[model samples]
Target: MKTFFQELKNRRVYRVAITYVIAGSATVQVVGTVLPIFHAPDWVQQVFVALVAFGFPVALVLAWCFDLEDGAIKMTCGDGRAVVTSRRVWILAGVGLLVAGSALTGYWLWHPWKRLSDAASMSSDTLSAPPVIEKSIAVLPFENLSDDKQNAYFADGVQDEILTDLAKVADLKVISRTSVMQYKTSAQRNLREIAKALGVAHILEGTVQRAGGRIRVSAQLIDARTDMHLWAERYDRDLADVFGIESELAQQIVSQLKSKLSAREKAAIEQKPTADLAAHDLYIRAKTLIASSALSTPQAESLLEAVHLLNQAVERDPAFARAYYQLAEAHDLLYLQGIDHTPARLAMADGAIQSLARLRPNSGEAHLAFAKHFYWCYHDYDRAREELTLAQKSLPNDPLPFQLAGYIDRRQGRWPESIKNLERAIELDPQNSAFLEQIARSYECLRRYVDAERALDRAIALVPKDAAMRARRAEIELHWHADARPLMSTIQAIIAKDSREGKNIAELWLYGLLCERDFDGALRALAALPIDGCHQETILFPRVWCGGIVARMRGDTASARAAFTSARNELAKLVREQPAYAEALCALGMADAALGHKEDAIREGRRAAELLPVAKDAIVGPLLVQNLALIYAWTGEKDLALEQLSIAAKLPGYLSYGQLRLHPYWDPLRGDPRFEKVVASLAPK
Candidate 1:
């Protein structure tokens, strides 16, 4: 051992080892800092470190056998012995080089990252290529070939039925009906572009004709990538055999795509939704109305008509589980949108859910109905999620389950999860503006104003003239930079385009005017509203309340008191009818505070907070708390007001920098150090 140590020192092997270690360490440190900037894969750094390590032994072997003399290579003459150039020494040097080379080659061949990259490249042509989804399709709306134009709904029904059947197969990625309906009237029939937009590889187009108790259906499936026909069929069957033809067509598409169909999926596809054709027609009509309506007065009327049709359909065939599911959804929407937020509306939804459960308890539609019921009516998020899990397993291609999960996540204060689920829904329903709107709301709650605006921009692109989305996009400026001019300009543009559109966004226009401290404009906007009132989500504020707010802001004490008195009277009736209505109660509490009814104001505000706490609903619950803080400020309880305001500032809600800086609602808390601290906390960081 002593001779080996002396030999290593004489050959300067220790010097080479030390230099290599220092250089390798510096190289690793530099590479570690530099590689991430270029977005290199993690394994690149690992492989680099391994290569440097392999060179260390080879460096020491070369140092032992050779020397650099007068800047030239020479054999090492250890202990003055004649330049030890032996066969064993050369063999050892070669072995060291061979070992290092073998290590480098083995790592390149056997590393997990290498295998992963190779497999990925084999699976796809390019590194950045999207995975090729083989069994994916979109079913376009069937053309109405009937002599009677009203039979378009019948054609739509047949297409929807076939699409629904295809959706049941777990092996296929079927585009949702909402996405495919856009191509119903597409004259050019650009199959490739349509399929790309829908994220599918195959397209199915068909036509349905009904003539004198007989139906003729023609369907053709084409590979969108190649624009080549893969399958085509024409069926002339009696009206009674329409369901059979739809089932057969779905089976043929599955077979052509070579998708694995479990026995359960096959049985589900074969089962008929309804035995009565008349009832089925009514159900289809109801579904169409629900799909086409928005959240406006027209939407309320449309939903009501749908409910009537669904009721008639169920009456015709009590076992129509699909009709019952649609009925439940329509009723839930009516109640949720505040068109008829009465208990009777919720009870109607409950009745439909009960009937659906009795007929098909384990069906995806039934689970979805129950999930909506729990979410909208009870605010029971946990139960809704439990139902959603089951619905997702059965309805893998449907976007509703993921959309509802996003809603539940938002209510639970899981903003990241909410955004993720909403994005997943967009993947399944790329054209759904509702999903974009919801994701925008989630981003807004998290104070990601830029992301929120981008989401709203996408929604506005999908629906160009949507005043609501445009208004929302403009509102992000106020939250981000405490500027309201952009929102005011957008509202003016919308109102200028059409007075009806202005009426639709009347509440938003008033809000913008108030933010700008244009009391006269606010009052004028309020006066132009319908005599009943303007709605803010679930709350219907009376015009008197709006006038009272303007009067208070303008310091017209007598007018403010009188307006509040009348507004209080009207809101009292509303609170009496719907005692559990949190938004209406909050509005009434503000009215009471404006009128100096301090005790009543505080009581109503506390009741509203108790009805919807932040734990139960993170989105609206903080707004209720903020309203209570306002009540405290109005009642001369500055300490309590500051405390509640501080709490609201830290929670997720609609409180924005513009509102805190400019709105008169927080006037009483002005000049207080604690209130200023709370406002500064909410300012964009």
Candidate 2:
């Protein structure tokens, strides 16, 4: 072993090995970075590294067989025929180099190809023998083939009906409508690509054509892996027979996909929602229009039009349960949109829901609508939970029920349960931005700010043009983290590109300025806002509140009093109209507190807390209680304030260390040890 080592040293093999390694590493590094820029295939870089590695052994063998002499490579002489051996060594070295180069080049080229072939075989094996999933399917939007493009709603209605029926089957994994409709207006991609994106094994594609009193639907089921049509059918039916067509299509698809259906599911599929074709048509049109309206920016005109259409639908067929449910949805949305957040509109929604319940005693749609009404209007969390449970039972496959359940859990401070329910909804409706945002809200309540930001980022990616999402992201950074500089550029860009989103951007700027205690900047932001009468209650309310705070900060008592009085009066009117409105009462309390009306502030704040007690309203409960605590702190009721703060800190709500540190309302509490402990409790883990 020692002689072998000495021979290696004598031949300078170590030097050759080190040199080869250094050169090989440099070559690999260079190729790895440069080849990618030229859009070279990954295999090209792999082959280069493999070739360099191959040269290492060849170089070492050459070092052992030859010696560097007089700046030239010469074969070693150990025998009598030194000249002959040197000549033969040169020839053999040349042959060895040629063979090794060829061999390495061949291996580099062939080895990856072989491994890739094996990988492909394995992939194919896994795909062919996929883990058992319950008959997963994605039903692409049916093509509208009518002369009048307005008939697109009719096509969507038919497709939705079929999907609705299929979703009732417990043994099937049906992707929700939101994800499936994304392919409707967009350019179609490969069927397999669509299927893979939806996490389904089968694809349902079809076209719909409607004439005066007749409807034509052509549907085919395909194996997503091979894009092979499993079944094809064409139905030419009377307009009134459309429900039957949907039922039959659903049955055929189930059979083709080999999914089992219980007796109840079969019964549900066979039942017709409405026998009157006119009522059905009107309901579908209203539903299509209502679906297009924005929930956050509800237009009164659009909602009124849908209401008119839905009213006509129910009048045409008084017993049409689906029409009644859609009518309720339109009414509820009209009120929810806050375009018509009046008692009359809320009463109308209640009336519609009652009618729906009377018409369809066990309808999932009725239960879901009632759940919304109970949650948003009545604020009856327990009743809302019961309704949601019934809805889930009736619509086991519907994402709406699960989503609503998640929201109920969120508002009730069940953070983990809320997350689980929202995640379930995401599994059903994978591309829903609203679901993603709600999930972020749940994360926020849990103080999982990082996870919340990630969720918001995902929601923003899905809806890049959504001003609400951008505002939400800004709020998290500015108000929750007290870090708004990073998001300032984005806010400015959004405002510059679309002045219409200026109001939302300005609100973000105001929050950012407030976080920094920049009173002048806050006043400037308030000035730049476009406050119109239509949005005075929403847009102007914040401006007034901020203006009051900034004026007080600058020692302008008269201006502060005027601002606070203006905000208080407006909020007082809202509270008078809706006595149970916790948010309006809280705002009034905040205004009173700002004006130094200690007694009034305490009264209004306590009233707000009573209306939104933590036992019944987890979402607004903690916020209102915290507002009361702020007032108490400012009025020097240290014990009362600390008690509220401790309770608020324990709840899964929006209280945070940043808010405690930055909010001017809580400035008086900063010196208190109890306040510091409460804020410290929320420290990031």
Candidate 3:
């Protein structure tokens, strides 16, 4: 054994092995760092590792069989001799130093956890030890410090751009714009408390000022746990370099937090949305309006304003993909509001979507915009799902994409997946009422009333002043919980707080009265709302339908006939003005049925059903189908009513099983075995 070792040393095989390892490890370290910068595939690193391993044995064999004489390789004989010299030992020592350097480089390149402080790296053995969190952050709404308060939109735009840039970093958990906007003018919560509430390690607060053609931005990063200022900076730049300011701010945040950014993320952070500053400003302003108007008391008018603003933005810079995306979103809101369903509106929305696709082919916002158009406008569930999947890949950090995906899943009867996606969205925007509301609705669909109620309570807490939100919560209580007491008390309290805003809760008041079988109270609530004040088709249709139903329940046949005639006249005019208005046609059909015009009801209902077959998954389609079934039931067509009920039970539209069981419209078919089966199927397993 001693002779074999001597021979190996004499042949320089041991030196060769050490040298090869030192060179190979150094090469691996370099490759690891450089490959990621170039956005190289993961397999490239694997292949490099494999090649290094394969070369190790080849290097040793070459060292044993060949000798370098004047840099020329010549055959050499290995003999048992003490040929180890000090030169070779010193060379080995140098190789040892090289190995250590390579090891240090490899540690720096591959092991990120090593960079964390000992306190942050402590084991979680102690019960009282604080748990280590990832590089998570929340960028609070930037204060508008401009001389002109109207420049508030500009400040918001600046903050949003920074937050968006930071979100591109996968290593950082960025709280979304929706959740952060709650802090826009709020001063009640301390930094530490706000960070804890948002589940972030750091909080970013900033101020923006825009004057004439120049801009100034000041930002600071604070340690949420200790309330320590980690970093702060100020920037003065021309309006044209606004994108640079955002990119620099994002880079500074990443640097302060020691967050790693992938090549794609870096590119995304630096990519400017538009070259036209005016157009970009318009887009940002539109986004701000859209965000504020989402599910607000007067969302329709606000969305229309945003739509007009986005149109100007797109015309200014036809290549503005984000503007086009926002335009599509505005159209989607208009569609969902049932304010307009004209082909011209649909075509304009489609044009916006096409612009998004052309301008930003790989953008998540583009995919999300197209997905919304498909899901809401076209009711193409499969195509919407596919686009959403692509959107998820493109904008993995965005909660909106996941939220939309959840809605699509719910519409397609994929309850578990829907809940999962909605929950994920909540994780990203914990305080967002829109996401919370959708989650509650999804839970209601599964008949998980308790969970649904809990979600609604959270949403109501987030937006207590929102009458529409209050109405929805009251609805959940009335139908799902089969309890009118809570709904009555809640609606009364909301009304007592502010009578003007209380009008918005009239629908819920009517629902509560109906739940208690109090027709007179429902009529009173309907009178308070008054058709003249209710412009939303959703609210208007419901008011007219419930008013007629309440009058019928009270045995006031004349009042019931008058209400039905009014609703029929209004809906008929709407259908004539916009023949594409499927919901209006359905409303007209239901009104006709209520007035005992069975043939007219059938004709109108069939026309609605045939006008938009794709809308069966939308609110209008199932609503039309349900009303058509109501028409069939009123005319003594039990089989058709049960058939429509079964179809509606599976759709996202119409009432809950509890509502179906108690609704007066379905009472005509209540004793039928098929109706019972359909209602029974709605019960959660």
Instruction: Give the number of the best model, judged by TM-score.
Output: 1
Residue 612 in candidate 3 has what lDDT? Answer: 61
* Positional deviation of residue 483's Cα in model 2 after best superposition, in angstroms: 1.0
Error of 2 at 32 (Å): 27
Order the candidate numbers by TM-score, best to worst.
Answer: 1, 2, 3
Which candidate number has the best lDDT? 1
- Model 1, which residues run further than 4 Å from truth? 1-132, 527-544, 551-563, 577-580
Residue pairs whose backbone atoms clash in candidate 3:
none
Local distance difference test values of all predictions, in order? 0.83, 0.75, 0.75
Q: Report the CA-based lDDT of candidate 3 relative to the real structure.
A: 0.75
Error of 2 at 390 (Å): 2.8
- CA RMSD (A), model 3: 21.5
Question: Per-residue lDDT for 185-233 in model 2, tens only?
Answer: 7665698777766678898989999999899999999889888888999
For candidate 1, which ten residues in a row score worst on lDDT? 121-130
TM-score of each: 0.78, 0.73, 0.73
Clashing residue pair totals per candidate (backbone < 3 A): 0, 0, 0
